[model samples]
Target chain A: MSEMLWGIVFLLIALLVGFFITSPLLIIISPLVEWSALMPYTNRSKMTWLIFFLSVLYLLIFIGLVSLFQSNFNGMFSKELALIFLSIIVVEFIAVRTTQKSLYQLYEQNKWPQE
Target chain B: MNKDLVKIILVTAGAVLFNLVFWNEKLAINTVLFDAFLLCALFFLYPNARKSAAVNWLLLGHLVSLSMVVIHNTDLSKIAFVITLLLVAGFAEYIHRSAWFASGSMLMNVVMIVASFAESFKINKSKPANRKGIGRFIRFAIFPLILVIIFFLIYRGANNAFSDIANRIGAQLEIFFSHFFDFFSWQRLVFLLLGLLITGSILLKSKLDYFSTRETRMNDGLQRSRKPMRQKRNGAFFSFVEMIMGKMASGMMALKNENTTGIISLVLLNVLLLIVNGIDVDFLWLHFQYKPGLPVYIMVHEGTELLIVSIVLAMAILLFFFKGNLNFYKRNKWLKYGAYAWILQNAMLVSSVFLRDYYYILKHGLAYKRIGVLFFLLMVLIGLVTVFLKIWSRKTNYFLFRVNAWAGIVVLVLATTIHWDEFIAGYNLKRRNTVELDVPFLLSLSDKALPLLDTNIVALQKRENDTRVINVNDGQPACDTCFIEQLKQREKQFEQRQKEYTWLSWNYADAYTKQYFRKRGLITSIH
Candidate 1:
């Protein structure tokens, strides 16, 4: 049981370290998130609306996660801990990669304005 | 890969590093390094900023900041540290890139960043569709992963035997998590983000597309009112304000129809001020006899405040009378002289105020209010001088303002150098301290004054002992215990206060005084 728990701990630490290392990119891409979300189509006002919705949704998700985890949990690696850690890592990776691809496509589009 | 990225990275590093301020004070060195980093960031952001004396001034500011951290605390170092902040703003303005203040650079950078928000955001949509596989994999894995964790926790909670196994896991987890929890509470994380925002706001550049030239303009009335005031065409809010103010502006317009009323009022105001000054001269100075029972402190206190307000009013009156056509049009020469006569009399009134406050300070004891009155007098003197210069030079009111602002900057640089705690302690603890030595007040002074207090420690201890004996003999045995308890309480208070004074607040006066006392074996070395 001890060995199994240590294995899980190591994995979680690795996941956090990964997020920490890439946080700079995430900070830079955060303000540009609306572009990626609305890239498949083009409408300035609609993108603004989507940005607002995304922010609200993120706030709700964050609040919900905090409420669930901050309460008493009876295990070393409870469902609350696992979900919070995993969700954070997933969000970081997704945001970073999505923003990177979106920005690169933007550069390409700027290069070929005729399109 | 890009210049923008390089600049952004440097700024981000500075932002992130600044948040570690609470972790350890020795990391103040990081603040200096980050300031240097900011210059480079600014260079990239404002490519047009050329080499000038201002750059040297900026470098001097950086060196001053560095010395403030490294050098022994001294009398002047505290002031120099504050001046460094002003110089940084001065540096920005000197390069003609921003106003000679932080708000200008802060606002400019914020606007620059926000302007590119949409353009930067477009990058998010630019991703090729082929990445759908990776996206699909993430979406596919996340939901069940969450569900599995929930199920696992619920299963463990249901069985009593599961806790025995979990305790073993708890031991494994605690070791890894302790270090994490030690440094990061939710509060610290919030401060960390705030640190980032401040850093980015100060250093980030949205664009470097233009060079700022001196002629481009400053956001002040002097520059705007110079080239023939134009009609408002920008927006409704401004036009509305203009429409309302149009009548008032015409009242003080360059061309005037009602000069007699303005001129007659100026003459009467000057006569009234002269009477006030003559009476002050007679009673406060000439033919003055001390009344043993009369309260003189109120004269100094109330009189200083009243005199300052009077001087300010005197200047405003001059400005109102001499404004626009009254200044340039030749018919109001007598009115201008009356204004000058009133100004000179007001100057004398200021002098009387200074004398009264100074006497009060010397007779009583040095305190913050005494120093504050002195500073107020200095400002009033500057205002009076500016008014005289405006009248004699026949310069625009805007020009007068521009000059006064610079004067204020110089005064500000001078103001920050003072170590008030030490000054007050030393002044009060002088020979005059024997008569009315407020031991409680002396003790309230900062640790920087500890050395001064230590020099007079024998006298102070004797005083405290005498007070305790007197109180105890007056049928108050509790005073004996209270004195000892007070000493213990004060010692605890000093120790608590000592913890907060670190490199961030390191100064030369404190260092010198601390060293003086430590050498004499009065106390332990100042931390």
Candidate 2:
């Protein structure tokens, strides 16, 4: 497949996974992770395993949130929802930066395209 | 799990902990706990943050400010709380590139963090496929929905059969969704989104170059500009004079002109302030009198504000003169001496303001504004000292700001540690014989002062009987019985409220107040 096609496909897969689990972090991170695949330096097999690992991690977060909502929320009528959303944002930012940094490192190790 | 993943999970867990601590409660011990959790999360997530002296100091300041909320929690403490949070966010972002920042960078860091968050959320137009697709879908969806609604209305009007079917379907849909509507809270969803935005602003490091670039360019040294006089500049608005004087002598001439202007201005200002300060010393310091029937405003009203303006203007004028090449001029010694004299006079002016507030508090008893005046005067004194330092050390204006800003923060944090309400109550009570105690004013104090008021009930009653003591709330004579009843009612309400507080909402002030009431038999022990 062409790199452009691969990019779109990865993006679709990311959106699909994010939609399924309702994790904004994965929605943001997955496509970028896939984009890393196009880099000459990225090990394809390692990227695959990373994606799988991330999916499991996203699933755990999904489950944790759902259970917390069930136990702590009775239809989400108050400020606790706000606090939960705040935490989600903090998590999303950390995840994005970490993923981006790791990808840059991978590319740099293999003679980054920009250089 | 990797450290990043652990950080993510820990942050989320901290949010849950935050929710549990603050759900349906006021800020108190819960804020302290959440702050500690956040600091720990930051430390673990950003190991480099530990190396930054500014970050470490801010962390300590944050802990102290949060603890003040549990101890006293006045408006000053709350303001300190918010300032500390901004400082934390600023320093956290700054440590991404370097571990050090100027003291003035506190404000800039806060501003940049906000700007960076805005930058991060900015949608990339280059990534057109995703945005365009989403935009097209929303546009198509909205257009069709509107057309459908309009046509449905037209059809309903034209055909009774269709109208009946549509109405029946709508009713059934509403009935089915009423249960869902009952459970769904739009407020909660909106608050959740708001929380997300705020949290992202603090935690996310922005890619903005505005603040960092400016910070990198900033230097504390007062460097002499080597720009040739031939190049026209804004400061050379008097270039025609330079032309007439000749370029070789122009730089020296301009420096002499600035130096002469500064020296003359400072000298005149100092002499004028000397007269003012001398008068203040004589009236407010040496021979102060408590004149009965004199309004309190005469002593501390517009006068204090006007003097404060002058004091600030004094610093501004000195900064204007000493701002540039004047500091490096060979003949600038006399000018510097004059500047020093003006600063000394301003310090004396600040002392006079302090004395004025002292006399006002002595006359009218302590209030928020009176206490605020003291703090404001303290800041002015510090400002003057910093300005003096700036001139003496040949430092940049940035140095003045950096030193003064930190001084302001230190004063604010220190002020928050005191229980002002109790302090006011105690101070006013001690001077009941010398000053007219404002009974209604004391009654309006926070729960922290209740113990003090209760302890002095007999003395308060005696003052209430004196015709000189008036209920400022009304034109009527003060009644001790009415005052005592009001006090008892407040005690009851305080006890009931204290009982409702969980461990999360616990604070030393409330706890001690409750304990005091319980021991006095005003509140029964809960089994």
Candidate 3:
């Protein structure tokens, strides 16, 4: 009974830590990147799909890491470590796209007349 | 006529009615005192209601009396009666808008009824006031009174029901208080305080504006007017937060709800497993020299596996919530399909466990071994399939992949049910042999020594045969030749033991046997 209780406590702690580390990135970066990628100058549809694919791949990687380390690691560190890696990757991806938003808008303006 | 006095009367009456109907002697007195205090507090808080005290008191008294009578008789059934009265009074007040006293009385009655009913139902449905001659008068005079009466009745009914049940089933109040304290041990309390701190920070960030005014009569009118203003003040943040919270909370709630149910069921299963394991362990420890079979170990293994599964499932739910608004499946059609496949696999795993348990119980007369193998297989299958699906969904987009995933789930469930009885029987035989060895000394005693000893043995043996043991040795254990041979062995042991000692001299042995049977929970003494 004690072991079971400890396991639940550990899992909750790990998840909470993961949420704290990820929430700021989700609030600031992800939406901004999605908004920028929809600019007319860029290939909006393709970019959207690319971003979506990358997110899925990142999630899958994290899922894999969690399963692989489930038995080897004890307590919060194992789960939190995997989630942090996933969150960082997402933040970097979103930052890259947002930097190019103005360029994409200019390109869309140039292409609109020809279309 | 002072409005403050009227409001006080209405509120007090509502409280009194609530207490009489719902509260037991102990709780009723407390409720009545609490109500009186609340009335005084409200009046002091808003003094403008002083003019209409008489009408307010009259309405309050009526509401209290009606509520007590209705609630004390039949709790929930009086809802219709209370609702009908509110409707009648509301219409009457609407017709007599010019008479402020009548209108105040009606409104007070309505508020009292609604408050009382709301407490009982835990819902907040209120009747709108009518503005249009006779309708206005009727509404003004009776509507408020009716509302007060309804609220009183509901509060009384709910309180009474909870108290009565608590009293009858032993003092649950004490148990609840103890459990509550235990639940909030220092560490848990600290966590709760931290959670509250976070909530406070969020609330502060939202910056809610509170209503503040000095005129008592105007304050009541102001509260009604401020409803729309309050909504406007927080509309954007409210909607945005609600949208985000709803999505996040729903996923978490679903997972939490499912896992909670699963954990409860799993705990019950574990307790059952523990009892069976303890009996077998005790038997093996006391009697047999050799180690028990794989089936015994298998049962323990299954219990551990189920516990692990429940934990994992619960964690999965927690993770889903913590992930925030990132719903991969909902955002992408392909991922949704993958999620559906994953759900199917999970359902299959749960069903397989149920089927396996059913099979084992049928074969083993509630012994542990019969159910162990099935649970072990289920756990392994679930772990393997989950990982496989996660990998496969990433690699393949073929329609056939989906088909195969679903097919695997169906096959897993079907196979468990098909061979359930045979599997159960194999385990039961192992358990029966363990029991016999454990209680060999008791079995050897003379018939006169333990008056019901022979009957107990026969009944146990019969149950073993009738239950899962028949499947052991391919049903050969119950065959005529095997049955006769087993009976002969028992008869020989009985005679040998009888010659060795008299009934009175075997008191120590008798006591030991009784203890063993009690521990096993198999000794039905009434027979």
Candidate 4:
């Protein structure tokens, strides 16, 4: 049981370090959020919705892990935890791609106004 | 402007905070504040003047200057003297720029002489006059002092953490003099020093208007000498070479503009060159491997010969085939593919020396210390590859080249994986043979542990054991005989395991090291 707990802790630490390393990418991308606002209402709202969905996805992963800990079924919980973590990674990747595409679309649609 | 100031402050604060977090470094907050105050004073003093860029450039330049000062292993007084000479030279340049030509030039020359002397003696000194103006003094001193304090604090913290990390990590860094001294070979050292001198001279000359004026004079002369007879005689050859060179130059410029493709090509070229250099040596061959009177590998070896031959052949081939094919490569898809291959081949050959040295380092521990030579060779290889690619590809667009470069990486990675087991096995075997061992236990132990031994200990033990036959008083048995006997036994066991599992020898050795270290209490726990 202790070994399992330690493993969980190690996984969490690794996740945290990974997040820290990836933070620079997020910082670089954060400026695009302002540019996203200039898009047509539908496109803007779509991106907002996507971001909201991503947030929800992250929350769900956290909730699933917490629930797993609360329920004392180790084998099932471990398997589910792994699946949840993998899903989180997939979702993050998808979110980044979507954000990038939305940014490109916005740029394409909004050419500079002629003098 | 206030926003810009705030941004700068925020960036500075963030930088400080990052250092504090990662390195537990303390910022000399008072010193920084003082510097900021002084900078504000300077801004106020030069309110109407267009000096912002100058100030910013000076500050940026000082970062390099101060770093050179701090990192250089010289006495404080000597450092101060050198700094004084540099300041004098900089002031002289400032004077020259302000149009005091002859006097400024003389002063600058004087400063240079003084600076050179200081350099020869390796002496640099800080200026007492810099402390005269309260704001100017603080502006100069405070920032550097803060940087120093922060650096020291970070260094202390990092050292402690690094020591702890090293202790936790089973592999410890040991410096072997043989590897270390090999880097300082006279030829390489002389070349490096010469290169530095040449670069310094070039920079100094560029700063003078002498070259510009001479170039202008040459251009004027060329324009004046454009007679019809001369034009008729030289027109064909001149036009041909000019067209080729012009296209090449423009292509390079275009490639530079297309950053992604150009960079990828450059990187690919470098990687290819590295691979070629790495394979230059007949690593598997016996005569080259076991040569007496200083390993041929240390000095110039078969690898060098192969490298020269490959480069010459590549150049000849490229010149012959692609002499007038630039336009074709640019327009035709098939030709472009061929061009890409040529680029890859060139890059591989150029980067081979670096890759080979890197492989040696990875094979041998940090104890094999010819890092200087390795770095020098790598630098030279990179420089040559860059120049070659620039000339050949004409600075091709990064976007156009990036995909191909990435494909090359994928292929290389695949090749690496294919050879991964052999490399690991070889490395482990070398490592194991190097270390001291209890001959009986070593002979009995699994073949997997043999490669992990330090060569120094093994060699020493080998010597001791060899002498023991003549003097029975020596307790230890012959290491080479025992090692061979043990290896034979382990080889049979390994062969059996190999039949059961593909590449079991490599995997077993890796696992054995982990287990050995774990048992030795080097590792706290395995992940």
Most accurate candidate by lDDT: 2
TM-score of each: 0.63, 0.72, 0.19, 0.26
What are the per-model DockQ values? 0.06, 0.02, 0.01, 0.01
Per residue, candidate 2 scores C-alpha lDDT tens digits across B115-155 of 33333333455885764476466645766986786566667
TM-score ranking from best to worst?
Answer: 2, 1, 4, 3
Best by TM-score: 2
Candidate 2 regions off by >4 Å?
Answer: A1-115, B1-15, B95-147, B158-161, B175-181, B227-252, B468-480, B495-501, B522-527
| Candidate 1 per-residue lDDT over residues B1-527, each given as its tens digit | 66546655665576666665434443234445555666666666655543655555545654654564444343344445534543453354334423233334445544343233333344446554556667666767778997787556655666668866877898877766655545546445656656655555555533322233332443323221332345424546435635755654334453444355566777887788788778888876776554677655787877787786787678676776665445666676777777778778888888788777766665667777878888788888888888888777665565566566556555644554455777887888785444456667777766667667666655566666677776766765443233234434554565555476665644454456546644764232221
Chain A TM-scores of each predicted structure, in the order given, are: 0.30, 0.32, 0.36, 0.39
lDDT (Cα, tens digit) per residue for candidate 3, span B1-527: 45434443444454444433333222222333433443453344334443454425333543453343222212211332233233223223222211232334444433233222222222123432321243355446566976675554445455777547646655665566546545545334334434332222211111011111111122111011223434634767445645655544234354344334434444554455456445544643344233346444344446446645653663354233222222322333333334344444444444444544553354334433434545455654554454444333432212223334334333333332222322233333346644432223333333322323433455555554555564675634344233324444654564455455433223332344344434544333222
lDDT for residue B68 in candidate 1, whole number 0-100:
48
Among incorrect, acceptable, medium and high, the docking class of model 3 is incorrect
Best by DockQ: 1
Span of 10 residues, lowest total lDDT, candidate 2 chain A: A40-49
Off by over 4 Å in 4: A1-115, B1-208, B212-300, B308-339, B350-355, B358-369, B384-527
Minimal lDDT window, size 10, model 3 chain B:
B205-214
What value does the lDDT take at residue B196 in candidate 4?
A: 36
